[model samples]
Target: MAHYFVGDIQGCFAELQKLLLKVDFNPSKDTLWAVGDLVARGPDSLATLRFFQSLGDTGKVVLGNHDMHLLALHGKLKRNKPSDNLTPLLNAPDIESLISWLRLQPLMRELPEHNVIMTHAGVPPQWSLETLRQESQLVSQALQQADYLDALISKMYSDTAERWEPNAIGINRLRFCINALTRMRYLFVDGHLDFDCKQPPENCTNPQLRPWFDFASPLRESHTLVFGHWAALMGKVNSPKLKALDTGCCWGEYLTLWHLESDQKITQKRLKKS
Candidate 1:
């Protein structure tokens, strides 16, 4: 069975299907993994969510910032914006089941057999893999519990905590973890998360900032880290251990699909307007 890791789908269902067809993907014999942002921005969010939900065990996804935003909208913690392109999904009869399935997905997923770990964003330099796993589980547990889900979603929207604190508790802790796992891109030299910059590393003019993967983390040495949140990256990073898969298919660019074992990259361009 082959493992295919795809970039942020972001409701680009037509492109995703085309990519799968390029690989002749068979769900019965192949596993599909996504770095998240499963819905939003592109057309057909409802169809995209339903398709992934139907994949069941063969498909795996981590939550992205968009996915969390979707949850917050569902829980009435946030209002939906028209630009999100999610109204169809929100009005779907199976919305509850789809959201529930999404909530149950972890923020970080580890594949020990492949010595790989994936999150929506890249790993933080300060976090050991074990700490990352534990913190991610904390958020996942809260999200899975109906009683605490709304409260957790309500507090998840801030960027105030830039650095990690071992003693951080309650909402502060959950917010920090969520930001690090799903929204992180750059870090200040001292290892604090930077929220403002989204430019490619070469174009970044800020001296204090560096891409998260540029930091010296044990995670880089221990496992192949795959992530997809930064579409501006256009699937490029310096290190062999780090893979940036988001190719901005929703932005009229191409979709990227990585064949994990062979390290082969397959891409499909966005469909042209008829």
Candidate 2:
């Protein structure tokens, strides 16, 4: 049973299917790890959500920013962007079941045998592995609670990067956790999140800002991190310790799958966006 980690799908269901077929994946045996964005900015959002949701026992997804947005809107926790196109998921025949299943997915997974940690985006430089584990559970608890709407509200706000003081578990703390898990890409010199920088490291004027995986990164000892948020950085950043899978598939780049064990690369069949 091979484990294949695929890139951001972004509603391209056909491409995903072709890529899985190329690897000869069997639902009963092989495991597929998705670097989220399972729905958004493409034509088949509903179909994509349904397909991944149906994977049930075989699939795993680390929630992306867009995926969190879908969850927020799906649960009525936030307003949708005018450019956001999630009508298909909202109107799907099994939308409720799909959303419930999606809510159960963990924000981070550490495969000890593989020594790779998976999250929708990079882990915060300040967090220790133990802290991440504790907070992930706290976030999961918040997600599973009666006031889940409140939790989702806190989870979607990425602008707040306040430090975790004491046992921080309130709304602001939740926002910090969500941003670290889903929207983080760069860090300010003070190690605070620089959430506004979307440009590559080379172009950014803020010398204070640094990509999440700079080899000497503060969190390097935690685990081999696998993340996918910076489509601007493209695939397989040189931080050899870090593995990025978002091959910009939604932007006409080929979707990619990297086998964790052998480091073999697989590309999905492309259907050019017109």
Candidate 3:
């Protein structure tokens, strides 16, 4: 009867198992919310994906940058950056099926009771929950259709505008998908997406850009939204309403999960550097 939200799992299946055990997670009764990046970088990417896919019932996930990249890269549609440490993943024998299921996952989830909008990077401050859900569905529909991944892979890098007009398509729709599913971090004072900034908010010098949750009213006043893209922000930001769960599990840090109703904390086993 409990709902749990977990941060970026990366490929840390062992840590995920330990954390689930610690929480006494019952698959039949409890729900697990994953903030994506389910595979890549860490060990046992195959195991992690298979384990969750077996959960099969109602494990909700939103695609993160790495997760999307894994799909595109595995499908041979896109090449990762030189800095990406995905050799272990590329070499895994079961990589094909692992990616197929990953690509089938949705890009956003809405919690009815808490009114929590769940996504990997979260909705931009300019977008309301309804607008965000509809747009995400647009992308999801295209993704689920046949030959859509091929289209998405072919036109992955064009449009970058902040506002959406009526029924935009092709690369424009792809841009919405990418922004919602992948590269989101900062929003401009005018509610535009600012993809340039990377430093933590405290160290950030750009006064024009703010986090997505700093918008005017209702969105700010509405129920809390949960997300996990910015590993640098870490977990338990203490915003009272907003919850950030990524604890940098892939980078020798701890994996974190949170309970929606009780505001409780759960931690997975951490890895030690050799």
Candidate 4:
């Protein structure tokens, strides 16, 4: 009954299967926590979604930027460029069901037993676990409402602000929460999100910007924070309490999964270049 936290799968179903086999994943006993980007930029988005969905309650997921983009595209009938590689998924007979299932997934998940919080991008240093939970609830509620879901998704594309303000309201606030939980990477000294820097810490050109977890309290409310999304990190962060699992499987890199109890990493290389 082990728990495995996997990095961004990004539609690489074959690699995901291989990694699961390596871990000896037993859906009946083992729990799989995915860091999102489950579909897009790989060979088989449809198969990837189906396989994860098959896991049912055993598989937990957070929505990544790509995942939300897919939902937005489907919900709004927006023009999708060919490069996204989502057409096959869009054309599937059960596309609506798939999208609905994805929309219902939360942006963050807390494993009480492990004292761990999981999200696509790392949580902002400014937000507490309670704040993360409350904001996630707001987004989840909006996504569940059919009439307003599309509108919310449509508003997701707006530019993000530098920092969070507790007083902020409406769609702007929702977008801020989404951006922080799913798209954030670097941050300015004042704890504002820095959208431009994606390079690893060693190569970062600007001294003022810091990785999101740099300011993390080693443990957030005594819980470990596990996240993906920054493949440039290659599963490395300075804090023992912070775990970065994205190894850029879609970019022909490794797919990493962390065993929760022992903190062992089980990784698999990409089956082929996308």
The digit string of per-residue lDDT tens for model 2 on 1-274 reads: 8888888888878888899888888989888898888888766778887777778868888778888778789777777664556886787788888878777877888778867888888887767788788777777777777678775554557575545454665776777888888888887766677778888777889888887676254457646788888888877477676878887777778788877767787987559766
Per-residue accuracy of model 4 over 59-175 as CA lDDT, tens digit each: 999999999989877876467768778899999999988988998899999898879999999887877778889998899889888765556887777656557989988888898
Which numbered prediction scores highest in TM-score against the true structure? 1
Q: Best candidate, lDDT-wise?
A: 1
Worst 10 residues of 3 by lDDT: 157-166
List pairs with backbone clashes in candidate 4: none
**Model 2 TM:** 0.92
> What TM-score against the true fold does each predicted structure earn?
0.98, 0.92, 0.90, 0.96
Candidate 3 ranges beyond 4 A from true positions = 80-94, 236-238
Candidate 1 accuracy as lDDT: 0.91
Error of 1 at 174 (Å): 1.1
Q: What C-alpha lDDT do the candidate models reach, one value each?
A: 0.91, 0.77, 0.76, 0.87
Error of 4 at 83 (Å): 2.4
Pairs of residues at least 3 apart in sequence or in different chains that clash in candidate 3: none
Using lDDT as the yardstick, the better of models 2 and 3 is 2
RMSD in order of candidates:
1.0, 2.1, 2.3, 1.6
TM-score of 4: 0.96
Q: Residue 149 error for model 4, in Å?
A: 4.1
